[model samples]
Target: MAYAADFYIQENIIGYTGDSQNKPTVYFRSGHKFGRITQAYPDSNYQGRSLVREYTDYSISNRPPKGTAEEYYNGEVRHCSRYPFIPVDDNDSLKAVLAIAIASYPYKKPIYSK
Candidate 1:
């Protein structure tokens, strides 16, 4: 069963003081009873530059680290250093889950008409 959770998005916008070009780095984090999951989108721009999104799903049985926010966030950063994709018993199930997650996000369509 799906559990209740809170999702957060952290964006880092980069631009020169006088430049109009803005580059964004987006990071997503969701926490649930089972565990927490995080995704990072680097060098995201209007051109849709492909970035390696990282994900981690900590099991409920795992123990939480004992430390402050710095340590916790640092550990998460390290955990994301590994590949994000998790192997599921059924490929179809994995695809379905991923599809739902992606659909939940408020993705903007390309402004081709304008």
Candidate 2:
């Protein structure tokens, strides 16, 4: 039973993890990884944790400040002193989700719904 959850950011484009020691989340972005999604336990160093958490010895050797957004690939900023992601309203979220998906894969520009 995989529980859908939120994510964090790392300097690496393919490294986003969760929090769980026994069965940490497993993520494989574009098949770039074959291990854990949530950084494989003791490996989760959320910016939400602490400097120790972000710079934990078991995690990435170069963990940026925890304020980095997970969507950094979409021109999202890499890091900030505070939460970097913009809060989207429900209608915007639903509409944008479809638009993004279509724009990311469709053959041509799409006329977005109003």
Candidate 3:
């Protein structure tokens, strides 16, 4: 499975959800730096550090009991619901993808520089 963090870099997507549709908007850039992924309401005015905190919170599993924030964000990414950059044909496929991402997170090997 691809590392969950790599999804951003692989897709090269950057934007917040659209105000009305909640559909994601794409503002393309040549490259991207993978960071945290989390939910931010369309109306929310999320600052840089706030976004970072959300990402960290999601990463550490400090989200709602209903589900982890990271999972929800990943679902959005997986489905291309909020963001159209990632393509997924159905919810089942997204779920399977999420399961793999979650399963892979804890066991991911660390990269060490030579």
Candidate 4:
């Protein structure tokens, strides 16, 4: 099955905003079983000053369950929502990618180094 972490990564990239450079937003979506990465951009906006926002609709598994902050910090549950940045930047989306990459040992792949 597609790892919940992968979905989390894709969602973060889709919603990422790189300062205000107007750089093209990038995202990665992995298949449930094969674990492949797909890139897509539903919509992007750059209002100058390096302010950018990307939007997409995706769901992830391995996320921390909703609860009070105390519950999460205490290690009561794995709250994915609490950790938005996993593989990449500490944004809501990158967290999933980070987790999946680490768990799958995809770091060996040269794609990330580039």
Candidate 5:
């Protein structure tokens, strides 16, 4: 399952980290580097590290909890009655998730290399 963090790269690329806790292998995206996937875990070395992808199925025994922040955000997205970006066709999940990633970040800035 792709979380909002999966859209960190370009619109077409997904910075895929599988459904387990492994250091995300390093890669470049939009002139920045991304790899460390758990900035939220309190590693002092990860200056400017993006928080780990918090969205995951509860059934995944090894994955982190889908934190309240994401739950609330998604709740806002799904429960809100005024959402116009909710698509009605194929790739609807993709478009909706990408829309969340793109428009939700602070001033639309992405998580970049430290």
Candidate 6:
């Protein structure tokens, strides 16, 4: 189950990630249940646990302090965080989720296209 879930996540990150004004955002299972990390606080670090929240009504202008937009997949709300990735288990050994978060994060732009 873990491997399948991880593969699914990876496939989504690669094939289904969306862009808003060229800003990258990740969608879980091709739905609006997605995340677009705007800015990381000065002390923000993906390597550490941070307070994460969920929001039903979200917008850039009318923003809240924490939490990410709710993502629904397989008939459940997919858990999300301010951190880069959602851990599949207690030990996120490979940090695959972090890689997805980085890919979807809007901090840097790609230099060239292949």
TM-score of each: 0.21, 0.21, 0.20, 0.16, 0.21, 0.20
Alpha-carbon RMSD to native, per candidate: 15.9, 17.1, 14.1, 15.0, 14.5, 14.1
**TM-score comparison, 2 vs 4, better candidate:** 2
Candidate 3 lands at a TM-score of 0.20
lDDT tens readout by residue for model 5, 1-114: 233355354343332222112322111132232222232224434322244333322111111353211112222331111111111233434433333333223221133433
> For model 5, what is the alpha-carbon lDDT of residue 30?
29
What's the lDDT of the predicted structure labeled candidate 6?
A: 0.32
Error of 5 at 51 (Å): 13
Model 4, TM vs. native = 0.16
Off by over 4 Å in 5: 1-12, 16-28, 31-96, 107-114
> Residue-wise lDDT of candidate 3 within 13-76, one digit each (tens)?
3333233122222121222223322233344332111111122212112233433222223323
Give the alpha carbon lDDT tens digit for every residue of 9-99 in model 4: 4343322222212332222343322122212223222111111112232333333353211112222432232223222444554445333
**Worst lDDT window (10 residues) for model 1?**
11-20
Quote the lDDT for 104 in model 1: 41
Instruction: Tell me how many clashing residue pairs each candidate has.
Output: 0, 6, 1, 20, 0, 1
**TM-score of candidate 5 to 2 decimals:** 0.21
User: Lowest-scoring 10 consecutive residues by lDDT in candidate 4?
Assistant: 44-53
TM-score of candidate 6 relative to the true fold: 0.20
Query: What TM-score, to 2 decimals, does candidate 1 have?
Result: 0.21
Off by over 4 Å in 3: 1-10, 14-21, 24-32, 35-44, 47-64, 71-114
lDDT of 5: 0.27
For model 2, the stretches where C-alpha displacement exceeds 4 angstroms are 1-16, 19-21, 31-63, 67-71, 77-114
Off by over 4 Å in 6: 1-5, 8-10, 13-23, 29-68, 72-114
